[model samples]
Target: MTESRPHALFCFGTLLDPRVQTALFGRTVPTEAATLAGHATRPLAVAGDSVTAAGGRDVRPTLARKLGATVEGGVLRLSDRELAAADDHEIDDHVRRRVTLASGETAWAHLDARPLRAAARIVIVGDSIAYGRCDPEGGWAGQFATAHIAADEHAHRVFNLAVPGSTLADVGEQTPALLPPRHPDTIVVAAGINDSAVPLAASDTGIDGLRDITGPLDALLATARRHHARLVVLGPLWLDESCTGDFEGLRFTAARALELRAALRTWCAEHHVDHLDLWEPLRDRPELFVDGLHPGTEGHKELYRYLSAHHC
Candidate 1:
């Protein structure tokens, strides 16, 4: 309809999640309660742990025409870009249909012809390293996603939500809003160089003035637990003397990096989370580093190999 919310889309499934909207559309579109008549949602057992239903069950939904039935959901206003994003997000499993809502407005709705299963989802969040920085092919996470987590046809959908220069505290704040009501099968993180450098550069927390990552890490773990996501934290990267002095007025030390990594290892051990250690293997390989902080193209490629071998 060319009325309000010209590109209206009725969401009755995961698209209802604000985090999913942010990840897909880059922003949450305004939504209003709406209903679809003469159609009903039927649940199907989803292969793999892709879709999570209420009460911790698993289900993939199929919207089908059923006389006198109605599906209650919200209508979202999507721009051209957001409409394309939404279509891309559900490209593997859903098809869009122009349907009449209870409000007598014609809108788009996502439906599955077969509605058999959903691709298991993997969500990654972190800093510049995770963002792939200087790497042309995104990063290791991007590589892993492209290579496929499983060899079968039911490959998982991947999303890289990492932001550059993000610290543990910043990540902790963003995690809750990054995940959906139904958690992802896995959550990968790559960060920490920024955090360790922050305190030595500027800050007087009344303690030792050095950054303590344990507290923020714990908080992050707690948030992940609430979502029940399988966490995989990429370990610290080694920096050369280029970083030892000061890059952007922020002093980075090998000692602090080691300390933070050790804490992360210990935390992962106690919490039973996955920690991929790249420090030792990468420390001596100075050529792998780009700006002495982030990894280069080859470095990311090498990291992809490591990730695929270990945890992809």
Candidate 2:
């Protein structure tokens, strides 16, 4: 009798596809669906690509009224060769690494750490696009999570707490609560469009809505610094006034979008946070967008490539 392979594989990304699994692993090993606690899955935007965000805060709405949710996927147990193939396939956007399970056991999982520092805990906060709005498989966050793992084998972990329709103020208010008690190694802030759309009321004080967003971001950064974590702030992508979609008729203008990007860039510089500009690449590629804002699968792929080339 042939002996079974002694490896267990945990998949939380595109490999969850049964066909993808069969294609990679053959019919040699058994596979099952597994969920890890204290971790919720969601889509994340990396550079210009998409990936899953795992082993972080629960962004599902019901969990805490925040953008809390669980990203569902499949787990497989296969031979070393299968794992190697899987690693190669994910190499373009992710890196494989070891993760401790909720049960206190260890297993290999993919991490996306292109712009991430080694052994750093990074947090990404944003709105729908950041939360992966139109992505069918998930979104850029999920894509980044997978690619980060597959690309950088040494990053501690990437946490994503993006909420659909969430404004910068929302992120400022909610993200800190979701973060671990200790400071993170890094924090990526991707908010502005939503905040710009509504435009804070004139009477609002303390920190204008935009600054409200930046305030929390600043706080997170300070906390990260105290904990010795780096800070990365991502500016908004391009916006073509002529294009329209889900967010259409809402009120976002190209000028507004540009202004938002400028503000974010300035903020990052002022705070001394690493900033990544996602506008130039997508500016000419109208086809990349499913609507004016969301990215299609091809768009997501392009985003991954852009991020891999620039950040990773």
Candidate 3:
């Protein structure tokens, strides 16, 4: 008798850790450092606020100074049992779904979406929050990956191409590289937090940073529409006051974050994009923060639950 080929799981977060993988899979599984095409990864950070990480200023404090090189991690492959364990671990916010790998192969993974009769290919584009910043096991995006279900289980896939500190400007330059050749059914825009943090003086043409924001947002929406994808715009979440210490230049109060949220809400309305506001419920809950900007375990779970329930 021949042994069965193990089920493959492409893990990009805490599960990339060998020890963590063992804990979840009951044994160390095969893994690799493969990049998912149409996505780039970067170090997660808190925007609109700050927090202490490694005893340094938390929010973009290393701007003038070189903090270090790039953040790195491995992608894991697991057996069916391990995948099930991962699903259970992430059960609070995600439902397991299928995805297409860079090599044009299909695999099962978690996705964030409400229960729907039709499964739509979802493309999430943004910075760290969409990249699964703070939560080591999985960020809200990861939870969303684990939670979304499709009308036809085999027909849908979700792609997350979020980069930490990725501003709208960066997305404009990188969209062609990050978007799949075939368009997705739905596109989620989770930007602006970084744009709000960038210095107002960076642009060469004397355009304000706000223009920098709108420029890319406009292009991104155009791209989505060209592909016939439904667009969903997500507003920024509130920043924990305690986390504000690290971000030197872009100091914003919770009220300011809410103000940004309101502005984004208006933007989405004008553009006809479906809007989801993340700040409304988290305004008072500092505990939801892992280090003030990033959501803790509970925070990830809550975000997933909220979005899943409200997804149309």
In Å, residue 181's CA in model 3 sits off its true spot by: 2.8
Candidate 3 residues lying further than 4 Å off, grouped into runs, are 1-119, 149-152, 198-208, 248-252
Q: What is the TM-score of each candidate against the true structure?
A: 0.57, 0.55, 0.57
Sorted on TM-score, best first, the list reads 1, 3, 2
Least well predicted 10-residue stretch by lDDT in candidate 1: 112-121
On residues 1-312, what C-alpha lDDT tens digit does candidate 3 reach at each position?
654466655556656666766777777766765433433332334333312333364332110101121222344565556667877754233445444455545454444433221225677888877888777866777777665544335645678888887767887777756665635756778763665553433453353345435677778877765554455777587778677654644544565555567767777767645567887666779988866666777887788777766763
* TM-score, cand. 1: 0.57
List, residue by residue over 183-260, the lDDT tens digit for candidate 2.
454567776376666333444333334444566667756554443345567757776657753353355667767777
Give the Å error, residue 166, model 2. 1.4
Please report how far candidate 3 places residue 218 from its true position, in Å: 1.1
Which of candidates 2 and 3 reaches a greater TM-score?
Answer: 3
How would you order the candidates by lDDT, starting with the best?
1, 2, 3
How high a TM-score does candidate 2 get? 0.55
